[model samples]
Target: MDENSIAGAAREFGGKVQGAAGTVAGNDETRAEGKRDEVGGATETRVGQASDTVRDVAGEAGDLADRAIDTGRDVLPEAGAAPRRGGDTLTQYAKEFPLAFAAMAGALGYLLAVAIRRRR
Candidate 1:
């Protein structure tokens, strides 16, 4: 958001400069191109805002999933220590259900990425 707003402001400033200079120098093309750039920058700012929203939503969802996983991990261990002994059992289950685990992991990773991107 900050970046987009900064860029947009920069573009706006540049456009004002270009338009002034073009008028003084009598160059229609420079004026037109400057207008185009100003528009592009505005569009980029909007896009950046949209991206930030998506990233925020994704990060929130990921945080929720992480909490759920933490709960599950907590409950499962307390459920029964027999057969499912120690941390190895969970690891083994993950290995056995590779597809399922992979899917979950993928989701988790995606959320993490979104959160990280938003932070940046």
Candidate 2:
């Protein structure tokens, strides 16, 4: 995992230990601080996990784009061959990379909706 995840895990463990110690010593303030730390650490760890997920999705999208470009190049007309239709090309891509295609289509739809709303 990322640095935030590692640090958060460590902090969470420390907080648990501190909380237990505070409970044994009957210190309410220390116990509260430990609990707060535990919450903060858990939040940080979740943020780190989300960040990693975003990074992975972005990488996948990039790879998909690159592959699409390569496929387009390979499909280019040679020896007077007829050009492929846009719909067919898109259908091919959607079948080959369903998730990436869906993600891109959703993003495109969202952007279009936002643009249309802005015009109104």
Candidate that scores best on TM-score? 2
State each model's CA lDDT, in order.
0.82, 0.87
Q: How accurate is candidate 2 locally (lDDT)?
A: 0.87
User: lDDT, candidate 1, residue 82?
Assistant: 67
lDDT for 47 (candidate 2):
85
Instruction: State each model's C-alpha RMSD to the native.
Output: 15.0, 14.8
- Where is model 1 more than 4 Å wrong at Cα? 2-5, 20-27, 73-120
TM-score of model 2 vs. true structure:
0.63
Per-residue C-alpha lDDT of model 1 across residues 25-97, encoded as one tens digit per residue: 8999988877777787777777777878888999999999999888987888666556557678769879899
Question: Residue 18 in model 2: shift from native, Å?
Answer: 0.8
What is the Cα-based lDDT of residue 28 in candidate 1? Answer: 96
C-alpha lDDT of candidate 1 relative to the true structure? 0.82
* Number of the predicted model whose lDDT against the real structure is largest: 2
Candidate 2: regions farther than 4 A off: 77-120
